[model samples]
Target: MLQIIVAMMLFFVMMFGIGFILNMLMKTTWFPIYLYLIVLLPLGIYYTWDDSMNFAQNMGAYTIVDYLPAITALAGAYISGTAIRSLRRGGYKMF
Candidate 1:
């Protein structure tokens, strides 16, 4: 329960941070910033877990699945930020 809560909190923080950055860099038009934020997270978690699993196996270490959410949050923030920047440049905003 605590882990889940923490993960959600992290996700929101990351999303907001990216949003702020994008808002500053973007010009204004039709890009789906929220869509990007929502979609990229799962991909990030999957990739991170896959890589982490491989690394742990090689090192003879172990891990729990609880870490994936945090990874997704971090990666989601980054992907969202980049997407926002691209969209802004492509001319998507409300100015």
Candidate 2:
């Protein structure tokens, strides 16, 4: 339980850091989303493959839920970064 919490916190922090750097470099709202999906998807899959396989073996199937945390974290970071950028650019209201 604690480990999971720690892992999630770390994940969020790392994603935020990456998003910040990407935003600094690309200066676009959408590019980080594309970059995160393109770069992290394969890496996430590769890293989680063993755990996913074990879960499938035990539970008889694997589901998208298993990967939701990573997807959500990446998305949250990207959205937050984009919102920050927009706020900086004087787009106060979120829409």
Candidate 3:
């Protein structure tokens, strides 16, 4: 349990760092989300292909749930950073 917690913390920290750098360079929330997915999707496929094949043989389908954590982490970091910047600029409306 502790290991899992630590792993999650590390994952979020890494994601946030990447998002922060991208945000700083690009200054766009949506672009970071796209960049994160583009980078992670192939890596996720490479890592999970065998497991997903085995599971698909039995379950008739594979799902995106395996990649949700990383995706969510990137998105959350991007949104959080964007929100912080917006708040600092006195533009709180996200819509």
Candidate 4:
């Protein structure tokens, strides 16, 4: 449980850091971040699978198939929130 929390926190921090940098360096459109995430997430999941498997084993019968989609949705939510903030801050033009 604790390990999972730590892993999740690390994942969020890393993703957000990257997103923040991109937002600073270029257009803050969620579209590109969305696409980047599609590529990055699978690699993240692959790297984290062992830890996830251990955590799941502790809980019983959790598969990557069962969890990946939910995690991806969570990632999307984070990116959306970041994009919304950037838009609100006038980083992006509405018109």
Q: Using TM-score as the measure, which candidate wins?
A: 2
Where does candidate 1 have its weakest 10-residue lDDT segment? 27-36
Indicate the worst ten consecutive residues by lDDT in candidate 3: 58-67
For candidate 3, the clash count comes to 0
For residues 30-94, could you state the per-residue lDDT of candidate 3 as single tens digits?
66567667876567656655653575563344444434466557756776577557654885443
* Model 1 RMSD vs true structure: 8.4
Off by over 4 Å in 3: 51-72, 84-88, 91-95
Best by lDDT: 2
Please list the residue runs of candidate 2 whose C-alpha ends up more than 4 Å from where it truly belongs after superposition: 47-69, 91-95
Count clashes in each candidate, considering only residues at least 3 apart in sequence or on different chains: 5, 0, 0, 0
**lDDT value for model 3:** 0.62
Per-model TM-score, in order, reads: 0.38, 0.61, 0.60, 0.49
- Against the reference, the lDDT scores of all candidates come to 0.55, 0.65, 0.62, 0.57
Model 2 per-residue lDDT tens digits across residues 1-90:
676666667766777777766666666666666767888776756665666357557344445545546766786677657766777678
User: Tens-digit lDDT track for model 1 on 58-82?
Assistant: 3344234445564555555555567
- Which model, 3 or 4, shows the larger TM-score? 3
Query: Residue 50 error for model 2, in Å?
Result: 8.0
